[model samples]
Target: MFTGLVEDRGTVQLLEKNGSAIDLTLEISELITNDAHIGDSVAINGCCLTVVEINSGTLKFQAGAETLEKTNLGLLSQGDQVNIERPLAADGRLGGHFVQGHVDGVGSIKSIDRDGEWITMWFEVPEALSLQMVPKGSVTVDGISLTIVECQPATFSIALIPHTLEVTTLGQKQIGSVVNIETDILGKYVQKLIPLKLDGFNERQ
Candidate 1:
């Protein structure tokens, strides 16, 4: 599990295709790699990837066909910047909401509206994914935890502070740019349970 807090921005060094999968290598800072291990789980663009190899200041991970099909990582190119975060520790502060580092679906930038230093970015997402969101809810976009300012049937808007724009990959995003999205886990469970409860109530009536 992760807290959706980006620790550092990593640069994609290489992408070696092997059959349907790929070996992804990223050049990150030693702050994360200092205590990192071979099997440490790192959230890269909100996707939980296992560190398979570490050399110098780079960490390597393998993305399978399923992961590639579901995330924006498959669209990554060499030299692209990716948000990176280590898994939350047992005693770590929950600065952000619980982020499983599991990408639910891919969303594209719909529009970007700037208000002075703040930004209100709209993203077009799948209807299914949007149904699990609500205004003021938390959602992880490209591994950055942001609050939903407005929720539509197939889109949502988020207010980005200047700090967020400066630190993460969202700063460089453009219209139609795809991003990995993970809806709040709590919302998913509630969505599931509500249907079951309603069915039970209808049967009793």
Candidate 2:
């Protein structure tokens, strides 16, 4: 589990395709790599990737076909910036929300509206993914936990403060930029149970 608080912004150093999978290398700060080791889990752009190799300040991970199909990681280039977060320790505070680093779906920036230093960005996602969101609920975009400001049938909006924009990859995003999105785990569970309950009620009636 992760708290969704971005620890550092890592730069993509390499992306080499080997058959159906791609080997990714990122050069991050010592803040994350100093204590990180092979076999540790890291959240890269909201996707849970295992650390397969650690050399100097760079970490290597492999993305299989399933991960590529479900996330925006495949679109990454050698010089792109990605949000990086380590898993929350058992005694650590949950400053953000519980983030599994599991991308539920891919969303694209539909529009961006700025007011002073704050931003309200709308993302267009699949209807199935939007159904799991609610106003004021928690959502993870590119691994930064944010609250839903408004929820629509096929899109949702989030308010981003200056600190968030400055610290994470959201600052570099533009219209049509693709991002990884993970809806709240609680919302997913509730959504799963509701349909079964409704079906049972209808059968009894």
TM-score of each candidate structure, all chains considered together: 0.99, 0.97
Strongest candidate by TM-score: 1
In candidate 1, stretches whose alpha carbon ends up further than 4 angstroms from where it belongs are: none
Q: Which tens-of-lDDT digit does each residue in 1-205 have in candidate 1?
A: 9988899999999999989999999999999888799999999999999999999999999999999999999899999999999999999999999999989989999999999999999999999999999999999999999999999999999999999999999999999999999999999999999989999999999
What candidate 2 gets wrong by more than 4 Å, as runs, is: none
- Model 2 has how many clashing residue pairs? 0
lDDT of 2 by residue, 1-205 (tens): 9988999999999999988889999999999899898899999999999999999989999999999999999999999999999999999999999899889989999999999999999999999999999999999999999999999999999999999999999999999999999999999999999999999999999
| Residue 65 displacement in candidate 1 (angstroms) | 0.5
